[model samples]
Structure formats: structure tokens, C-alpha cells
Target: MDPRIDFLYLSEPDMIAAGVLDAKRCVEVCEETFALLGKGDYLMGGANHNNHGMNIVFPKETKFPNMPVAGPDRRFAAMPGYLGGRFDVCGNKWYGSNHANIEKGLPRSILTMMLNDKETGAPLALMSANLLSAARTGGVPGAAARHLVNKGAKVVSVVGCGPINKACFTAIMTQLEGVEKVVCFDLFLDKANEFARWVQGEYGVGAVGVDDTEAGFRDADVITVAASRLRPLYFEDEWIKQGATILVSGPFNTDESFLTSARIVYDHTALQEAYVEDAIASGNKEAYYSGVIGGPFFRLIDAGKLPALKDSTSLGDVVNGAKPGRADLKERVIFIACGMAVFDISWGFELLQNARARGIGQSLNLWERPHQG
Candidate 1:
């Protein structure tokens, strides 16, 4: 065997050329990844194998002048996982996020990903992952929309007008047909109008910005909450249409009543359970509710107010044909996504393969020889 080692480096444009922005394909791969998760063919960080990942957080007060202080959406995180199936690859996504970055004309989170050979532990590729992450994040809801959305769904309600939701809208429009209009709401009306105009120009759909959050939900067939909220926003059950499907990609957007009344589905049950376990062990059960999108439901389960794990179903089960999706037109469904590292690994592996096929990325030498072992 050759002892020389090299790896591919893909920039954002290289990734796009390698089909990283193909929303429909991303959804298909995400569905397959979920099926593998259902079959127990994946390993994430932590001993339980379901941990989200390791996050580095700073304290609110620091004695050191150079040390960063805690603020909104500020932290460093490393999400590592190994996925097994047709694509057996290990990878980690590293990101530093600060909400204040927006003022400097940068995204809140800037990410990079590294894929490895599972057996040999050698680097295969290092790629810019902002688009990869957003596409996979949006693909979860796209997959849900494919399986759970009612037929002839005409209107889509979008709560947040950020880059993440832009990817989500692209995926949704690609997967679902007959989407006629988009009703959008944001804390900044200017942002909402800007996103609406983009949707109109990109998808050729009617887009409208609403001043009221409730107005955005009226008569909508699908609702997506991608807004950045530091506190919970309660929605009256009456505000939601009977057949509407709500996709939540952020924290504290809905309340316990809506969750209890809806047919709740999660990307994965064990991951959320792991969050609950961590919160309890840390002696702050309330943090689970405040920190996670599905935390309130889990808190209710802990309090015995809701059935333990019975009132909800896993999206993987639905994907694997073990459970049904959207049984009736009037059944309101809520999909809560906590964002998995397996998705990044899966999509990154595919992008790397595509880059190799298309001869798109730069090749960098890792070592001239195997110096150790």
C-alpha cells in the first residue's frame, strides 16, 4: 500500500458545485440516515451514544480580560459522529457562534467539517460546512413534509427570515408541489419583507409579510418556526389550522399545551432523552425546557402530566415504515428537530464523493510517510 497521505479540501463554492445545495437529494439522504439510526447503526458522542455533542460555554463573568463572556448564541461546539450503512464514515463539525457576528456581516455560526476513514482514522476531506449544515438542517423538515404534509397543501407560514429558513424554504419547495403562497413573520419587518421578496423571486410564489405572528399562521397548511428566540412564545391552539403541520428548528417557540394537543414527532427520541438525563443530573430540570425545542414535553413526561414516551413517535420509525404519518387530514403534527451530527457526516460523505467524481476540491498532503505505528 502507498504510505503517502492526502485529503481533499472543499470550499463553499466547491461544495455547491459538488451538489451540496441540492435540497431534494439532501432530504433523501437524511431519510436514509434516519433509517440507519432506527437500526442502531450509528454512534454519536458521549457514553450513551446519543449525546448531541460537546459544547464549550463561557461564563457570564470572567476575571481574565481576554476570556470571552457569555452572550446570545455564543459558544464553541464540536459535533462528532460515525454513521454506518451504504456510507460508512466518521466526521466532526466544529463551529464558533456569536450572534453579534451579524453586525460584522458574518453569519452567527461559521463551520468547518472533517471526514475520516472509519477504520484507519485517516483524514479523507476537510470542507467548508455552512451550506452543508443548513441544507441538512432543512432537509429534516423537508423529509417530514414529504411524509406528513396533507395533500394539496397551498400555503406555507414561516416565522423566521434567516439563512437557515431560506434553506428550509428551498427544500420544502423542492420536495412539495402546489405551494402557492408564503406568509412570513419576523421581529424585524424589514427582514421579513426582504425574505418574502426573495421567495417570490426565487420560487415564483406569492409572498407576504405579516405584522402579527398569529396572522402568519392563519389558513396555512405548513408552519415553520426558525426564529431565534431567547424565551418561549405561546401559541393558542385555535391559531393553528386543523390540518397544519408545524416544523420547529429552534428553541422556545411553542408551549406545552400546543405540544400536548398535537401529534408530536421527533427526529430521534433517544437524543432528546439524553438531553433530559443530562439536565436532571445537573440539577436544573428547567434548563431542559428552556434550552431545547422539545424540552417542555419531556418536562411534562417527567412530571407525570404526560405519558412517558407514549404520546410521541420517532421520525425514524415513520421513515422505516414502523409507524404511520399524517393519518388524517385534520391531524395536526409537530416535528421537533434538535439537529444531529450524523446528518453532517452523511451529507459531508456524499459531498466528498461528489467532489472526487467531479474533480472539484483541492488536494492537500497530510503526511509524506506513516511516522507512527
Candidate 2:
């Protein structure tokens, strides 16, 4: 009997060649994924089948000299999922992150993804996933912008000037038309200035750097917050104009009053439920709320400060026409997207297929004969 097994290995360059950086196509694919999610055709890690992923975090202090202690953004994680539909595949993303990587001239997180055949559980492809991760992460907001943002929205305010926000801007540009300006705010003035210049050069939009967050949000039609923070960053209700949509891909900093008043939408309702369950089970509810981007809202619901989450709609529902998106120009909407593993699997699967069609990756033989069974 034939026993040969092989898998495709794709480096970052190969992933780029396979169209990993195609923001428009990535957004479209993400939309498809969201629809599948709404239909319950995906399975993520955890008992509830809606977990984001499993992470291994080190302690802040370790007695052993060889033992590693945790620092900011330092952890190892595995994000696994199965996405069914026309694209039936299972995959896992493995990444290690250390904030100090920046000091070494590298990104804080380095990631790789492995796609497998659902039926056989055989490796299909192993690929660099930093770009895949970024594109899919950005595509969530991009897809929301397509359905939620006001048409011909002219001004966009970006609160973070990091790589993730850069990808978000690229995805937003792909999905929206007539975006005339981008105002950026960052703690580091130089980073904000650099991002402003980048936006101007890349999208030819009028880009400005602002010292104050309020100035960044003033008169903005769409606001995206992608900043990484351990503590909440507050956005006063007065800063948000009527009819503006805020896409939150990072930790929320606003007060309870603003959240209760805004039309809240989630990337997926079940995922948020899972987050709350996990937080409660872990016994430090407040820490989870403060640490996670969408934690506060769920915490408020748990504390009876806000209504139950059933009142909110999932972006997937909107994509599938199961619910309405952006009822009126006067309505204020805030989209909270806690990144999902399905996105990584979906995009990785597509990239793998593209690489195969283009003959863009190396074929590595797993074995010529079965080692067991």
C-alpha cells in the first residue's frame, strides 16, 4: 500500500506571493468566514467550542534561574480551529510573543500556521502566519466598515500607530470608498507622525498627526482603536460625534454610560459568551475584563450594569442578512472584535490553496512509509 506523505512549506515570501497581503480579497474571505460562523459551521478550542485559543503565560517571578518569567506581551499560545463549508479544513496557529523582541529588531510576535486535512488529519501546509494573522485581524473591522460605516465617510480617526492599525487602515481603505482623511494619535509623537506620513503615501488620503486623543476623534466619521494597553484608555462620550461608528479591535477605555448608550455589536455573540464564562471560571473576573479588549462590557452585563448580551447583534448575523446593520445615520455603533481562530484557519487555508495553484511552496515529505499502525 502507498505510504508516502507530504506537506507544503510556505515561507513569508511565499505567503505574500500567494496573496496574503490582498486586503480586498482577505476582507471578502473574512466575510465568508463570518457567515459560516453565524451558521455554526466552525469549531474552536474549548468545551464550549467558542474559545479564542489556549495560551501559556509565565509567572512574573520565578525562583529557578533557568525558568523564564513573564513580561509584557510575553507568552506562548496555540490557536486551533476547524472551518467547515466549501473550505473544509482544520488548522492551528502557534506563536511566541515577547515585547522585548522589538529591541532585537523583530516583531513582538512571531507566528506560524499548520493546516491539516479534516478527514485524514494529515498535514496539508505549514506557512508563515504573521501576515496572515494581521490581514485577518484587520479584515474583521474592514468587513464591519462595509456594512456599518456611513457611505462616503470622509474622515477616519486611528488611535494607534502600530502594525496592527496599519493593517486595519489598509483593510478599511479596501472596503470603503471616498475616505478623504485619516487623523492619528499615539503616545509617541514620532510614531504618530510616521504613521500619518505612511497613510498619506499609501492611500493618498490627507493624514494628520495629533497630540491629543480628542483631536484625533474630533469630527471623525469612523474611529478605529487598535492600541495595546494594560490599562483602559478612556474615550469620553463628548468626543464621539453622532452617526460615527467606532470599531474597537483593542481594549476599550470608555465608561459604562457610553457603552450602554451605543449600539453595540460583536464579531460573534457566542465567542463573547465563552470569554465571560472563561473569565468567571478563572476567578479573577476583573482582571479578565481589564486585560481583554471586550471584557468590560461582558463584566458589566454580569454585574447588572448593562443589559444581557442577547440584545446585541453579531457582525456575522449582519453579514448573513439575519440582522440589520447601521439602521440610520444618527445611530452610534461600536463594533467589538475579539480576534478569532477561525479567521486564521480560513485565511491560512485559502493561502495554502493559492500557493498550491501557483506552485509557490516547498514540498516536504513527512514519510515514505508508516511508522506505526
lDDT of each: 0.87, 0.89
> For model 1, how does the per-residue alpha-carbon lDDT over 1-373 read when each residue is reduced to its tens digit?
8878899999999999999989999999999999998788999999899999999999999999999999999999999999999889999999999999999999999999999999889999999999999999999888888888897899998878888888787777776789999998887799899999988998898999875778877789998888767545556677888989988887645556776778888888889888887888879778656777877778778778666664567898899998887889999998888899999999999999899999999999989897896
Task: Put down candidate 2 lDDT per residue, 260-331, tens digits, no spaces.
Answer: 888888999899988888888989988877788888787778888876776779998998999998989988
| Clashes by residue pair, model 2 | none
Least well predicted 10-residue stretch by lDDT in candidate 1: 228-237
Model 2 residue 13 distance off true place after TM-score fit, in angstroms: 0.5
Compare the candidates by TM-score and give the number of the best one: 2
Candidate 2 Cα misplacement greater than 4 A, ranges: none
